[model samples]
Target: MTLLDFVFRLSNRVFRPYPFCHSRPDRSLCYHRRYFGLCARCTGMYLAGCLMILSFPFRGELLSPTLNIILGTVLLLPGGIDGTTQMFGSRESNNFLRVVTGLFLGVGVVLFAEGVLFILIG
Candidate 1:
C-alpha cells in the first residue's frame, strides 16, 4: 500500500472507540468532517497535561512542597467527584464541565507528581 494509505489505515485503527476513548459522538469534539478519537474530557486532560509537562523547564520553585500537595489535592477534587458521581449513576455531566474538570485533573496530577517526586528525591 502507499504511504498515505498506510497512514490513513493506521489512524483508523488508532482512533477506534473504547479502551482509550469512548468516541461517543455526543461527547466528542469534531474538526473538519471528523470526530476526535477521545471524548471531550480526555482531550482536555491530554491537552493540559502535555502543556503542563512542556512548561516544566520554565517553572520556578515558588510554591512550597506542602503547598503543592495541598493545591494539587484541591484541584483534583472536582474531576474526582464528577467522575465518581457519573460512574455511580448519581448525576450526569455535560461536556463543558467534563473538559473543565479534566483540565483541573491534568494540572493536579502534575503538581501531585512533583510533590511525590520531591518527597522521594529529598
Candidate 2:
C-alpha cells in the first residue's frame, strides 16, 4: 500500500470508533473499540443515528418541526432515561429493563438526529 493509505488506515484505527454505551462485564465493546463499540442497544442507537442521517434526503415541504421533535424524543427518551438512571445508581435494573431502555434510547437517538437534519435542511 502507498504511504498515504497506510497512514489513513493507522489513523482510522486510532480514532474512528465512538464507543458509548457499555456493560460492566463487556469491556472489549467499550468506546474506541471502533464504531459504537457497545452492546445491542448501543449498536441499535448507532444504527438509528445512521438511519437519521440517511433519512435526511426525504424531508418534504409539509413536514413540521414540532412533529420531528416529538418523533425524536420518543425515539430517544426511554433508553436515555433508563441509562441515566442506571448510571446514577437509582437501582440495579434487570436485563429486560436494560434491553427495553436500550431499544428506546436507540430510537430516540435516531429521532433526534433526524430532527436536527430536518431543521437544518429546512
Candidate 3:
C-alpha cells in the first residue's frame, strides 16, 4: 500500500472511540472544515504529552525529583476535578476548558512519571 494509505489506516485505527477518544464532532477541534479525529481535550493531551516527552531530557536540570512530583500533582487537580464532575453528571464541560485542563493533565502525567523514574533509578 502507499504511504498515504498506510497513514490513513493507522490514524483511523488509533482515533477510534472508547480507547483514544470519543471523536465526537461537537467536542472536537475543527480546521479547514474538518473535525479532528480526537476530541478537544484529547487533542490537547496528545499535543502537550508529545511536547513533554520531547522535553524530558531537560527536566532533570530544571527541577528536582520531589519538585517534579509535587508540581505534577498540583497540575493534575484541575483536569481531575473537571473530568470527575462531568463523569458524575455534575455539569457539562466546555471545549475550551477541556483543552486547557487536558494540557495541564498531559504535562502533569509526564512530570509525575519522570519524578517516579528518577526516584526509582537514582
Model 2 per-residue lDDT tens digits across residues 82-103: 7678789996565556556665
Tens digits of per-residue lDDT, candidate 1, 15-68, equal: 663487776767766554456666778877877888988998899666777787
Give per-residue lDDT, candidate 2, residue 64: 66
Inter-residue clash pairs, candidate 1: none
In model 3, which regions exceed 4 Å deviation?
A: 1-14
Ordering by lDDT: 3, 1, 2
Regarding lDDT, does 1 or 3 come out ahead? 3
As for TM-score, the candidate ahead, 1 or 3, is: 3
Cα lDDT over the full model 3? 0.83
Model 2 root-mean-square deviation: 7.2
Arranged by TM-score, best first: 3, 1, 2
Worst 10 residues of 3 by lDDT: 4-13
TM values, all candidates: 0.79, 0.54, 0.81
lDDT of predicted model 1: 0.79
Instruction: Give the Cα lDDT of each candidate.
Output: 0.79, 0.56, 0.83
